[model samples]
Target: MKKCCVLIPYYNAGDTLLSAINSIDYDYLHPDVIIVDDGSQITKAADVLKEYIGPLNIILLEMDSNKGIEHALNYGLSLHGRDYELVARLDCGDLCKNNRFSKQVKFLDENPDCYLVGSWVDFTDMDGRKLYTVEHPSDFESIKKLMFINTTFTHPTVIFRSNILDSVGFYPTDTPAAEDYAYFFKIIKKHKASNIKESLVNCTIDPHGISTIKRKRQIKSRILVIAHNFSINKYAVYGIIRSALLLYTPRGFTVFLKTFFNPNR
Candidate 1:
């Protein structure tokens, strides 16, 4: 069996932490779970995790100060050498489907050339009720369409090969909000990437989440997206124009616009 582990970077999640952990059905693919607390102010977050303590390798590494997600992720990755073939990412508030790890592991095992693998996801409200499902591309050509806009391949649903980290390096610390987007562009440009075409994760859309509330972060993310990915003047100009327009519209409207204008869509 291929060795795999799930890395979760959490901050002030409180009771939601256990739900995230429990959502992954480890019985199918028994992978180690590493949770790094990113200076959460809530004391109960730590205490709540204690309830689910058992034989599982649920290691908790706490940081004294908030180091941001990139720092927390890099810290988690530093724990293991090259023994593990795959490293799965999970967020503190999101939940993985029952066979998420098992399916991702099997996909990686079969498709050795692919460095990164993600799955489709269902967006849910804070109450855990499903809002709608997101379908992602499964092949390389379709994956390139992702450059035009980000469809739902929630960060938590992605499982990447460990060696790719050596080539791409850790997530760019300078760009916190769109760090994953930056990292994905690097991987797709340099290595083979694809999605599983299966809905294997439930992404919670917390109304108060940083991704939603922080407008400046989203604007900053657009700048990073153009700077890191599109080096050509034409492509960069196009990306900049599109990103500016995207910022003004609601996310739902932006998605619809992309779907209508995008050639692949």
Candidate 2:
């Protein structure tokens, strides 16, 4: 496999960051890892990095202030992504499947037209119990259609070509919590993107995370993303209605629906 590294944005991640870094099967891919500390006040998160002794290089960058994850991610991209062929993403509390990087790297190597690629993810609880799985459409057409209503790629399960960022630019910081959605929207229009059929990551759905705590803002930003990408078409309406329900209804209800009626399952 070509040289690739993982880029992780850290902010008060505590031990989760260390655990996440350790979980990657470095012996298989031997990709260097970079974690940009986004002005985390919690010292433990930063302190734990000192304990990671591994075969792969671990680059830790620091920011003086909390500038949000979008900026932190862009900071990492600007700093180190230029040298690697691929850059994978793994959030603080996420666990990668043993073959995650190998599969993603192989796919990127084989498909040069694909700018970015992601895989299915399993959403788990604090105790690591699987709650539900999110599987995205693998074909570009299905992904584009679904992008209006939902995020087609799992963020933590992605391994994108380095040039894709060069072409599309870094993640937009304007959207706050919805930067990934907006970034993907731009990517889908400019280049080919798809997901692997298998689940490659287990994401911890923290109730207090931005998705739950800032659902209203995220939904609003998603609606704006739809407006920017598609005109007033059927897909736009579907996007609005889907976002409206998530915004208006209680999160618990939406979680229930996702757990029980998730189309991928």
Candidate 3:
């Protein structure tokens, strides 16, 4: 079987980091799980890491000071773990089903044309109550079509081939909150990407998460991503126009529209 490594970047996650690690059924996939401490503000996260006891071969890397998610994720991706055939990602507070890595690896193995694969994701509240499930297009063509509108893949729920990282490069250090969206646009242009029809990961919707707290910044970055990567077409034009319009609206109103139109996302 091919090898895969799990990469998680955390910052001030508290006990949720440990809970996230514990929730993974590592026995099934047997992949090395690497967690990076991106200069956490609280000792709880570091203390929890020190106390972790698990069968999975866990490697912890810590930075000197608090960097944002983009820096932490890029640092994790830069590690030697890329020797594995595939690299999977999970957030500090998300839960992966026992079969997630296995299923994603199988899909990649079967679909050689695909460079990245994300599964349908279950969104839950902080208490783990299911909010809804997000289902994205499973084929490359449809996935590309949706790219101009929004991110088709859930960053934390994705499993991508290792080789593509060198070609696409790491997450943009400058993009900050929209690093994943910008990076996805960069990769999807050169490689095929898709999403599985079934939900394989449960993503916790933390109101305090970077995407929530700095959503307007993320949106602005996304517009720039689309502007640079997309050709002058109807989808590109529409995306640029819509994103620019959203910029002037109140952040709360934009959040409301997103919740109403695409709550699962």
Residue pairs clashing in model 3 are none
Order the candidate numbers by TM-score, best to worst: 2, 3, 1
Q: How much is 248 displaced in model 1, in angstroms?
A: 2.2
Evaluation by lDDT, superior candidate among 1 and 2? 2
Rank order (by lDDT, best first): 2, 3, 1
Best by lDDT: 2
Model 3: weakest 10-residue lDDT segment is 251-260
List of clashing residue pairs for candidate 1? none
lDDT of 1: 0.76
Per-residue lDDT of model 3, residues 1-265, tens digit only: 2488888888878778877787776766788887888897676356887778887878788988988888887787787546688888888889988488778888888999999999998877789977667787898888887789878999888988988877888888767688988888888889999988889899887889877778789888889888777886787888888888877776556545545677555
Candidate 2: residue 243 Cα off by (Å):
0.7
Provide TM-scores for the models. 0.87, 0.95, 0.91
lDDT of 2 by residue, 16-92 (tens): 88779877978667998899999988663569787777676888899989999899999999988888988899899
Regarding TM-score, does 1 or 2 come out ahead?
2
The clash count of every prediction, one per candidate, is 0, 0, 0
What lDDT does the true structure give each of the candidates? 0.76, 0.86, 0.82
Candidate 2: global Cα-lDDT? 0.86
